[model samples]
Target: MAIFLTGVTGYIGSYLAAELLEQHGESLNLLVRAEDSQEAQRRLWRSLQLHFGFPVFHEHLSARIRIFCGDLTSPRFGLNDEKYDLLVSSTDSVLHCAASLNRKSEKSCLNVNLRGTLEVIQLARRAHDAHGLRRFSEVSTVAVAGQRRNEQVTEDSAIDWDRSDYDPYARTKKFGEHLVRELLPDVPRTIFRPSIVLGDSRRPETTQFDMVRAFVFLGGLPVLPFRPDDCVDIVPVDYVADAIVTLHQSPRPKYEIYHLSSGVNSESFRELTAALAEARGKMKPLFWPELEAPFRAIVERLSRRRDNLGYTASRLEVFLPYLVWNTVFDNTRVVAELRRAPAPFSSYCFSLFRYAKENRFRYPYREWPEIATLPSTARDSEYSESARHVSAGEPAK
Candidate 1:
C-alpha cells in the first residue's frame, strides 16, 4: 500500500513530499502534471531539488516513488482504465495538496479548486470502496475563513456561510472543503489550514516568491498605508508542512481540522518592520492607517500598467485584503498536538526579505544534470515490487 499524494510540485507541497520521503518509510504514488514520464521526472526534480540532491532523488524515484502523469481537472485525472486501476489498487491513503491559488480568476479557481478536488475525491471514493482507504488529507487554506477582521478564529468557527470571501481562490476553497465533507463522509479525513505561509525558517532560499515579492515591495516603502499594530499572521513553510505530515500520519489526531497558524504569537506591523529595518540599519517605515483607502486606489491604478511596477502592484492588490484584515487563525490545536509553536515570522522575515531582494525574487533552481542516466519510465511491476518491501515504519531501500 502507498500514500497517493498530489501537488508534489508546489512549494509547501514540496516540503511535505520531501519530509515524507526523507523521514518516513511509505511508498508514495505521486500525481504530477506532465505530458510524459521524462517531463514528470524533471518537474519532480525541480521541485524536490530544494530538499534532495540528484543522487538521492534518483534513488528514491526508482525505489519508492511512482509517478502518475495526469491533469487534476480531467476525468479520472485523465488516466486510462489500466493506470487508474493501478493507482486505486496500490493506494491505501491520500494527501491532496494540489490547488489553484490564482486569486484573481474565478474560472481558474472554479475549474481547479472545485472540479479538480472533486476528481481527487472521486478517486479516493473508488480506492476506499476497493480496499478501505487508511486516511484522506486535504491541504486547505485559512483564506477559506472568508473576510475576517481582528478576531482570532478557531478551526470550527473559521467557516461562516454568511460571510463573504476575499477572492475567487478563497471562495472556491471554502466550497472545496464542503465538497470533501459532503462527498466522503465515511472516509477518515483531515483538513489542514495554513495561514500566510512565507519563507522557510531554516533557510533563506525559496522556490515560491509571489508573497516574498509583495512583502519586498511593501518593506521598501518609507511610508506604508496600514495600521502598525495590526497583527499579520505569518507562519513558516517548514512548520506548516511538519504539522500536516505529523498529524496526517498519526493513528488518530485529536481534531479533524488543524489551523497551522501563529495565532496570538503573530507579530505586529511595527515589530516586523522594526526587525527588517534594524537588520538593514535603516529607519523603520512609517505607517498611516488613515491613508489605506487612497493607497488602495493608487494600487488599483498602478495595477493597470504593463510594467514591473504594475505586476508588483497587481500581486499586492490580491494580497492587500489579507494584510489589513488583522486577523489570525488560532493554532492552539496544532501547537498542542505538535508540542511546538511555529517560529515567529519576525525572527526570519529579514533573511527572507534580504534574500528576495538580492536574488531579484527568484529561486536559483538547479536543472537536471545531463550526465544523469536514470530511467524516468519505470514499469508498474518495478514500482509494485518496490512497494511491497517498504512499509509504514521501515525506510525505503
Candidate 2:
C-alpha cells in the first residue's frame, strides 16, 4: 500500500523522499541501516532535517513514513519473516536509490552495488507475485557509459559490454543494470542515469560535500592541467531529483530510461571558471593541457599524505578521469518529458563553491531535538516492536 524506497539517508535519496512526501500522497516504506527503530528515526532526522524543521518531519514520520530497520546487503534486507511479509504485502512499488559510490574500492562496490541490488530485486519479485507491482525505479549513474571522451552519449548508446569502465563503481553499476533487466523482465521498470550531480540550484545549502571539495580544490589552483574548452557534464541535485520523482510516478512515461544531465548545453571549464572569477573578483586560472601527465603524477603523490591537502587530492584523484573525459550524457528524453531543462552549472556553481569554502567543506548538521517524541501511529508501533524483536533475536508478537 506504500512506495518502498531505499537510500533515504543519502543526499539525492533524501531529496526524493522530501519531494514525494510534500508534493504527492504516497506513504513511504524506507529501509534504513540501523539496529533498532530509535536509531533509524535519528538517522532519518539527520538527513531529512536539511529540507524542513523537526515539527514537519516528525508529523510526516508519524503519518506517512514506515521505518524498516535493515541492511541492503543482508538477505531479505535482514528483516524477519513477519516484517518482510508485511513489507512485500503492503508495498505496490519500489524505488532503489541506494548504491555504494566508492570508486576506489572494488570490494565495497561489489558488496553494496551488486549484492545490495540483488536483495532489492528479490523484494520486487515477491511483491509482484503477491500482487502486481506498479513500477520499479533504479537510480543509476552516467559513468556506466565507460571511458568516454569528447562524446555525447544517449540513453540507448550509453552501455556497451565491450567498453572498459573507468572504475569498479562503473563496472558493477553497468552489470547491476543488466541484473534488473534480466531478472525482472515482467516488472514495469525505469532507469535514471544522472551525470555529476552537484549542488542544489534553488538553495546554497547542501549536506554532501565530496564533489564540492574536489571542485574547490580545482578552483583554488593557479595553473590547471586541462584544456579550457573541454565541457564537463554537471547537473544540480534539484533537477535530477525532480526528474526521477516525476517519471517514477508517471503511469506511462515516454521512455524507460532518462539521462538527468546537462547534455550538449554543459559549460566548458573556461565558462565555469569565468563565472566564479567574476563572482570572487579574481582572474581566471591558466589552463595548460600539456601539463596533464605531470599534474597527474603530482596528484598521485599528494594523495598519499595524511593531511588536508591529501584529503582533497584523494577526492580529486577519484574524479580526475570524469573531469577530463569531456563527455556529456544527452538529456533530450528527460527534457521532453519534464518540459524543462536543467539549470546550467555556471549559473549556481559560485554560490555552492563559496558555501563549501566558508563552511570548511563540512555541512553544519543539527542534532536531533530533545523535545521530539517517538512516532505513536499504530503502524509505527508495530514496526518499532518488530525492529526491537529482530535486534534482540526474538519473534514479534
Candidate 3:
C-alpha cells in the first residue's frame, strides 16, 4: 500500500508522513514543488528524516518513500505523463493537504482551495477502486461555517452559505465540500475542518501562524482594551495531526466531517491573554486606561524615526490583534470521536504551553513545570463556563 500525500513539506504533512512511515506498511509519494525533481526529492527526504526526533525514524526504509516534484495547479500534479499514471494507480489513499493558506489573497485561495480540491476528487475517481483506493481525505476549515451567528454549526449543518459564501477562501472551502459531497456517492470522503492550528505539541517547536502567540507576547506590555473573556479556537499542531490520523483509523462513516478544534475548551480573548500572561508571570486582570495613555505616547514618539522607531515598533506586530475577536469552534462531532479513543489530553492540552515556555520557543517566561501545571489562577478561572455559556450556537441570555 502507498499513501499519496500532498504538501508533504508542510507542518501537518511532515508529521503525518512521519506517522505513516511509522504505523502503516505503506510508502509515501509526496507531491512537492521545486526547481529540480531529483534535488527537491532528496531535500524533502533529509527534512522529514531530521524532523523525526524519535529513534523510530527508519533510515533504511528510504526505499519505501518516494517524492514527485509537481505543482498542485498543474495537470496531474505537473508530473511527466508516466509518473502521473503511476501515481494515480499506486496509491491506496490520497491525503489532499496542499493549499494556499494566504488570508490576504482571495483569488489564490479560490484557485487552490476550490479548483484544486475539485481536481483531487476527479483524479481519485479515475483510480481502480477494485485495487483498494479507499479514500480522499480533504483538509477543510471550520471557517466554512462562516457567520452563522449562534447556530450550532454541526457536521450535519447544511454548510450555511450566507456565512461561508462571503470570504473567497471560505467560499472555496465550502465549494470544495460541495464537490466531495457530489462525488460518485460511493467514493469514500472524509473532511477534517480544523480551526487555527497552533504550536507543536511534544515541543514548543512551531511553524504555525499562531496569532495567540502574538497576543500572549503582547500581554506583558501596556496594551489596553484587553478583556478577559475574548477567545478563539486554538488547537495544538499535534492534536490537529492526531485528529486527522484518528479520523482515518476509525471505520469510514457513510460520509463524515470532523471539526479538528480544541473543542469546548475554546479560549476567549481575555482567557487566551490570561493564559499567555499567566504562562509568563504577568497576567493582567483589570482595565488600565492610564497604561494605554503612556503606551500610545511611547509608540507615537517612536513612530517619528523611520529607521529606528519603525524597527522598534515592528516588535508590536505579534500583539496587534489582542484587543478583540473570537472564533469559537463547535466540535461536538470531533469531541465524541475523541472520547471513544482517548489519547492523553495532556499531550495537547495545557502541557503544550508548558513545553513552549520551558524551551523558550514561545513566551520568554519561567517554566511552569517540566510539564505545564496550569496555574491555580488559570485553572480556577470561570472562563470555561463563560466560553460555553456564550457558545456560538446558543442564544445570549
Please state the error at residue 31 of candidate 3 in Å.
0.6
Off by over 4 Å in 2: 373-397
Instruction: For each candidate in turn, give its C-alpha RMSD to the true structure in angstroms.
Output: 4.0, 4.5, 14.8
Residue-level lDDT of model 2, residues 1-397, one tens digit each, is 8999999999999999999999999999999998777778889989999997876776687678898989999999899998999899989999999999999999999998999999999999999999999999999999999998899999999999999999999999998898999999999999999999999998889999999999988888887899999999999999999999999999989888899999999999999999988988999999999999999998899999999999888888999999999999999999999999999988999899999989998889888664444433324214343334333334334
TM-score of each: 0.95, 0.95, 0.73
Alpha-carbon runs more than 4 Å astray in model 3: 45-50, 53-61, 128-132, 148-152, 164-166, 209-213, 224-227, 253-255, 283-327, 340-397
Pairs in clash, predicted candidate 1: none
Residues forming the 10-long window of minimal summed lDDT in candidate 3 = 378-387
TM-score of 3: 0.73
Worst 10 residues of 1 by lDDT: 384-393
Q: In model 2, what is the error at residue 183, expressed in angstroms?
A: 0.8
Query: Per model, how many backbone clashes are there?
Result: 0, 1, 9
Better of 1 and 3 by lDDT: 1
lDDT of each: 0.89, 0.90, 0.59
Candidate 1 C-alpha error for residue 291, in Å: 1.3
